[model samples]
Target: MSVSNTTDFTNPSTFILLGIPGLETAHVWLSIPFCTMYIIAILGNITILFIVKRERSLHEPMYYFLCMLAITDVVLSTSTLPKTLSIFWFNSRGINFNACLTQMFFIHCFLAVESGIFVAMAFDRYVAICNPLRHSTILTSHVVASIGLAVLLRGCILLLPHPFLARQLPYCRTNVIPLLYCEFIAVVKLSCGDIRISSYYGLFVSLLKNCLDLFFITMSYTQILRAIFRLPTKDARLKTFGTCTSHLCVILVFYIPALFSALAQRFGQNIPFHFHILFANMCLLVPPTLNPIIYGVKTKPIRDRMLWLFTHKRT
Candidate 1:
């Protein structure tokens, strides 16, 4: 590995992220694929947001959450990529504590909101499955609004105190972040003082929310499965399972990487930094970026409607 000896890594005031290791030599070539993914991620998510908001036909709980998820995806990707592009191409990796804290805040907020939305989506599926007759009534406007507010409130409240723990700590040395974004934990790990308080606060919030969310999600699936098993017809069972198939797969994809990353980070596992970056990207990339694709492919009716709307609007 050729070290850029000219570029100082020990700069205390401004941090320099290597962006992608060994990519500085081929900056243009290295950026193409990442830029493409960013573009596609941006476009796909924005399109979903546009479709959800614009089309009067898609005014439902599923689409509502889908739109929220799209918003999260765009925010998540935006939080990382601009800095990445700047660092990789322009070598401008300087980020102050307040700026870093602000980025970290939104990232955590959106992440919490994303998790809540997914759990709500799971509950929505369970409701639709278990109580088909009253699905509409159960998921009324008031209920949906309450759920949205809950997601937002939970996101903001938990993460609101984090910036205090971060901004107060003196980053006396290199502010270099290993991963792409100014992630709260990763950035806080670089603080000069003892981080026990920050860790405890973060961990308390994490373990509490994660365990509860997982428990409820498990209960929901278990109940849904039990309800499915009682079905008299094979077609009914198949349909019941099919409805949640995409959500299940996506939830697994989203949660597993996150769980692994959390464990690896907390346990101080000897995971390679690059692998850490990869998984970090995967966690953010897969759910927000691939969710629309999953929904589009799994729900043929939605795909048809989307294309029909596009075609009609074009002509």
Candidate 2:
């Protein structure tokens, strides 16, 4: 939405987003499919959250982290999807500068929380396999709660200062963000003046959060593999692999595109914006919608319960 008398320092009144070049005409129609996908994704994540909340059998540390993953996915998807959908459905890309900053803040916060949750889940997996005897005590409910709180606090701390950086820049250029929603890099690039320091800070935060998170997750998985190999029984090995399969898949789908987009932004290697925007968006939408189904619908216990809930069939 447009703010009151807030003018771009260069253009004073108008801000054009150089949007997906020529697709503005078709965006209104495209939103139909976008909305459909979003509804399904949002509902699926919510279902996962509800299942974890209701099923006492699913109260292990893995599931606890899974529940928080669902929460972060919901927030992350909601942060951008609705706004992007609105622009397409209504052709109303009237986001003000401050409002754009708000969106960026939430997007970064949710992304950070999701990354932290992934890292914590990896740690849980490591403990479950490499240190089975201590898993129960090491990952008690209180410990899980504490981890969630730490993630929340860390997300807020990481993103809160980012908006202030935007506030420092005088928007002396065209206001059009080139993307549908207010993407941080795209928005920051719109500044007419130098933003070397801003870009440096952004790079620092991105690296500190994403690379470090991926590093720890990888470390955990490496240990898990060693422990799985150490198991004497084939059944034990299969069980360990089975439990980690869902999370491993999630990590792949969530990380690859995100890391690619981060690289594209940092390097500016002349990658097409459309490609960047498309994959970048998929990073947000695809995971949240698919995770619940991949994790829950495919699991024997969850599938049976879900089938019973829907069909009223008794085993």
Of the candidates shown, which would achieve the greatest TM-score relative to the real structure? 2
* CA RMSD (A), model 1: 3.5
- Runs off by more than 4 Å, candidate 2: 1-18, 263-271, 313-315
The estimated TM-scores of all candidates read: 0.88, 0.90
lDDT for each residue of candidate 2 in 147-166, tens digit (9 for 90 to 100): 99999899899888877877
- In candidate 2, position 153 carries an lDDT of 97
RMSD of 2: 3.2
For each candidate, what is the lDDT?
0.77, 0.79
Task: Output the TM-score of candidate 1.
Answer: 0.88
Could you say which candidate leads in lDDT?
Answer: 2
